[model samples]
Target: MKQFIVELINDRFMIAAVLLFGLGFMNLLLQKNLIKKIIGFNVMDSSIFLFLASQGYINGRIAPIITNGVFDAEVYINPIPSGLVLTGIVVSVSVTAFFLALTVRLYGIYKTVDFDEIMLLINKEAE
Candidate 1:
């Protein structure tokens, strides 16, 4: 019964992740605002990260990070996904910062956040 419950939970989590990924991709493709696009990108990243972390978990397993010198491979969860999330967090931060900076510059030049409005403004200004 316990194992069945665990499998059911895992299946639900995977399904949710797949749905999130689909929505995130759709948002990324559909949104015109840079902020919305960045949010979608972050959501997509989170879905994958969650999936990785879930895979690292095991029943009755201790965390992978050892306190002393004891290396219990059989009971410990995988640390790779944690490390991966850390690196991804840093990368995502940098990307968001760069995107925001670009957005600010775009606004400065055109004084509009709307993509269509900015393009039209720039064209008119150019004429």
Candidate 2:
């Protein structure tokens, strides 16, 4: 137990990110409210971004930007993954906006934002 816990402590940031993403998605699926589910989706998106950013950090490394003009020249950090994560963060922001719009439309159509109610109403309409 001690060894396992010790190992987990070293990688806890990643572990936490994974758990946050999973739990957020699970909540989105298990919840019955449209707004609540979208909030969960946003949480899941953030967890992924956090994971990516945290993974790029090294114990002792200088900034990747050479143009910054301040470095010991002995150590450098990788910039590729961090750039990708920046792009991902932008995408997450766009998706969140889109999801919010969808939620608004959902509210307009059903007059109630609850997923269960929406599903029941859609089912009734289809039949």
Candidate 3:
């Protein structure tokens, strides 16, 4: 048990990523406001990026850039995760912007950003 605790402490970034993911998932499920939901989505995206970055990093390895002509694979950390995190960030930002724009349009039409309120308004309009 003590060893497990130490290992967990050493892998703090992974633990933090998992905790952040859970928090974001809970927020996404429990929130009623459109803006809050979008924020939760962003949190989830960030957690995923953090997890990827942490997974790609090594204690003694350098970035995958060539230095002093050291053409050894073992000396450089994997670059895939860094690339993936960068791509994910771009996509996350675009998605977040789209969601916010949609929320704004909904607010303009219904005068409320709450999901329940919007449903109630729609139901009233239908009747």
CA shift at 1, candidate 2, in angstroms? 5.7
Model 2: what TM-score? 0.85
**Leading candidate by lDDT:** 3
What TM-score would you give candidate 1 relative to the actual structure? Answer: 0.79
Report the lDDT of model 1 for residue 41: 85
- The global C-alpha lDDT for each of the candidates, from Candidate 1 onward, is 0.81, 0.85, 0.95
User: Which portions of model 2 show Cα errors greater than 4 Å?
Assistant: 1-3, 67-74
- Candidate 3's residue-wise lDDT over 3-122, tens digit each? 999999999999999999999999899999989998999999999999999999988999999969999899999899999999999999999999999999999999999999999999
Error of 1 at 20 (Å): 1.6
Quick one: best TM-score, which candidate? 3
Q: Local error of candidate 2 at 10, Å?
A: 1.0
lDDT at position 64, candidate 2: 81
Per-residue lDDT tens digits for candidate 2, residues 1-127, read 9999998998988999999999899988998887788889988988888798778877788668777667655577767768988898899889889988998898899999888899899999999
In terms of lDDT, the poorest run of 10 residues in model 2 is 67-76
